[model samples]
Target: MTNRVEYLRSPTAIRERCNELFELAQADQLPYFRVDLTQLDAVADYVIAVIREHYPDLDVPFHSRWRHFEVGNIPRVRQLEQAIESRSKIEQAKAKFDLVIPSVLLDAGAGDCWKYHEATTQKTWARSEGLAIASFDAFCQGAFSKHPYQADATALKQITPEQIGAFFQVGSENPLVGLEGRSALLQKLGQTIEQSPDLFGDVPRPGNLVNYLIGHADQGQLSAVVVLNAVLIGLGEIWSGRLSIEGVNLGDVWKHSSLSGDQLIPFHKLSQWLTYSLLEPLQDLGLKIIDLDQMTGLPEYRNGGLCLDLGLLQLKDPKLAEIPHAADSELIVEWRALTVCLLDRIAATIRKKLGLTPESLPLVKVLQGGTWTAGRKIAAALRPGGTPPIQISSDGTVF
Candidate 1:
């Protein structure tokens, strides 16, 4: 058996293999994408099995339904519903969360090249090499201070101290995948921005989110895959910006690249969707938003709809709810890799269904229309089924 395990940790290897898979997918080779679906399904089944095996008593947080809970004697979800009932507030929160939180989660040292409102804060913090958690925490603190929080002591007291402090933990702050928590904090920050635009600015600057992702990925002279997920998922580009990579401009390079001259996939549409998902709270705060159709989705999900339903991605086993599951070496690698492979499966399905040639196919398009949409759909689907699996953890970062 070729050990498929190593691919998750290695960026260079991942990019390389992804290219290889892309080629295979272009040829409509089913084995390239579907070979491991059964295995992945088994893996997911096994994870649940393992949880049941080891901790039969563990209650997984897979509350995929809706229920009301009070926090600070106020209903958080209800507050959100009330806010977005208005039209203008909806626009503001969306743009702000989309543009702001992604940049806020990057390491303090790297987001500097991009000229943002508080780029100086990023430049000043200067994260230590390989210190993602600490760096992320510092970024959150700065961003939070800049967010719309109550200036008055009464409101401050009403706020959960744990929630407030959770915003500053630099390393993985998410309740689930613990590997350098990224998404949850961004999500939280987005919600905060949505709820309190009076404090945080509306509208994430064009490309600021992307710049932060790229720059943070390159920091310490090494790329972190977890960080990459944070960047791509939270702040991907709606349109490819003209930029130099390895002495070649992206626009020119893209032409010669496999996806060039292909029907524009509107990959940014998926990205825009995800950006919208992340930024909806910000939208509630009275900021203007860019058009949702502007961004593309990540290759992780292709052909739209629910990613969880399509079996491409699965949430962390709710049974391991409190264990900081992302830090589990075996589990994290298995889940992320499974997700990646499934995403490719979605692309392969699209290629075959659409009759598009590989070189000219809108790979980014499929990602936006297909898989990314699925992930968001699944996320939305989970809202009404049970108590959503999202746990309020005390990590300074939000997913």
Candidate 2:
């Protein structure tokens, strides 16, 4: 039982399980969506066009939460770097982890209405950008720690929904979805860090993960999967009301009826996102990050939405789009599983078009220059406020 649970938490499991559903989708055995390979070429072309528009020279960064910090071309991460420039290299890495870990956890759907007004820049930002800026501002003000730049467990365990709401400037008119869930996640994160002394260290800080990963590095080189494993093991318990096996909480893994036995499918979307976000800091510390493609594409709305908007995936029941679906529902789970498979296909097609290999143009880069932005563009053109084709009821956790 424990071994099966461990397998479910692995990247191989994510690919294999999602591929199983994709095969079912291809055979027209799935209940909700149809696979449209004919439209894949058009989808690939659209994503390539978006890539060209964003990066004409074809250089693209990894798709991570860090990109949100650069919203409005504001150089927010640069500002943080400058502030912590005097710290030692290890401390700097820790600070980066401190900021991005919570930021990514807070980065579920912000709904269509919520917006953040940056007092420094006098700019109004919405959605992910807004959430990033809000969390950034809160961190800058020491919302997560006594010091203005660290996230210590003592502070995080005591965080409240009202405090998060205040930090985000949430009010009746400017409501953010899943306020309590977001707060609870952070509180749990604090507890997880405090309890996992081997990973977080005795100091009980999120930044201590830097030390843990550094220790795990083999000759200053690490696989992306190692980082992902640390993330899942260190922070898995932060997830609320998730499936568990032998007392192991399966964060972001879900269920689908098409599969036999447990019918479980894993899509550790946010954990993988956190892993991607952590890579830059590891790289900055001069650690070589290898096996980059081992980590699968994030199975989120943007990437999944790209598939739906471009007709790569068509819903058998078109009415499914009009109603809000729970994140754990079979329809949503299957949609996300199909998304994981399609992103690989899209990445391959994009690489072929650009005459590049997976090494030069990895799935993460494809997501950045490629699919996610294309999805948003298509969504904006197809609907009001650039909403996803399928509406999901968010709980400030899973998308």
Candidate 3:
């Protein structure tokens, strides 16, 4: 019974299968894309420069949702703590979990034209940072709450499109990309948490996961993979119309032509992202999460776009850039999978050059000091609006 289904459950599964496809593409056996190892060193050089430029002493934090909360140099999370000073540390951490889960889920493409002005910070924000600030503001305003008092898990379980859209300023004149899809995903996430009282608890708060992790933690330690697995399993029902096997909803896992037995390549990009985001919160709870690199590099737009923009991943058809593609298309999946594989290779070179161990400069740091920034920088130089090299019709959940 614990056969292929188990393989589809972990972040490691995503790494293994993506590695396989990467190798096949290297041998020119896979269609839709080709791997260019020659440009990898150049890619490495650019990322290293970006890393050194920002973090001169190389004190890079793990890339996560926490970074976005501080947009415009505002310590939004710290502010949240100050506002909720009466709560216990555990309660605060749980509140953070509640905010982070939906905030991360709400993070998709905001499109080019839309922008957010943080009224408190007095700074204009756009894209991910804008979304993060807006979500944080909404959380503070009790958008996720059923009562007017405070943010709660059960409240998050009953979120709506109007709440999401109004906070993010979505309207006919100011439209957001994937607005409906984004709203539906968060609404479903609420439902999933409500049903999973065992994991999420009776009130089913997202922060209840912090308590679950604390219980499963061995000698005050928890596995990073377990956190991701919990997110994938607890919220599996959130992602609709994706691949499923044996009656289990494989959240973010997809099919590919690379294998037949279980071509299900799991790229729990957002889940892994949430796992990274929870690092500091769990640390605040006095729990240590080990095996950071086991989660793998995210295979989303920025990292994947770095590969395409750098010429490390060449489209088989040059004209394909002009077309709108579904997120699950063969070409897009291949690109996402390859981005996962290549980020590992690139991280190795970055660590080697910096004379740092994986513990010091994990893939998470490399991504933060790392590839995603480099990709966006390059995309800005190569294309107008700094759009990704390939267009993906992302539902709010996946990206």
RMSD of each: 16.7, 0.8, 1.5
Candidates ranked by TM-score? 2, 3, 1
Q: Give TM per candidate.
A: 0.31, 0.99, 0.96
Error of 3 at 104 (Å): 0.2
Write model 2 residue lDDT over 213-300, tens digit each, in one string.
9998999899999999999999999998899998899999998988877889999999999999999999999999999998899888
- By lDDT rank, best first, the candidates go 2, 3, 1
RMSD of 3: 1.5
After TM-score superposition, what is the CA distance of residue 291 in candidate 2 from its true location, in Å? 1.0
Which ranges in model 3 have alpha carbons more than 4 Å from their true place? 147-154
Q: Candidate 1 lDDT, tens digit per residue, 12-104?
A: 444443344344443544221222344344433423343344335533221101111121233433543454455354343432343333433
Q: Could you give candidate 3's per-residue lDDT for residues 227-283 as a string of tens digits?
A: 887887798888899877767787787778775565778888888898899878898
Q: What does the lDDT read for residue 226 in candidate 3?
A: 84
Computed on alpha carbons, the lDDT of every model, listed in order, comes to 0.32, 0.93, 0.84
Q: How many clashes in each structure?
A: 61, 0, 2
Score candidate 2 by TM-score against the native: 0.99
C-alpha lDDT of residue 241 in model 2: 89
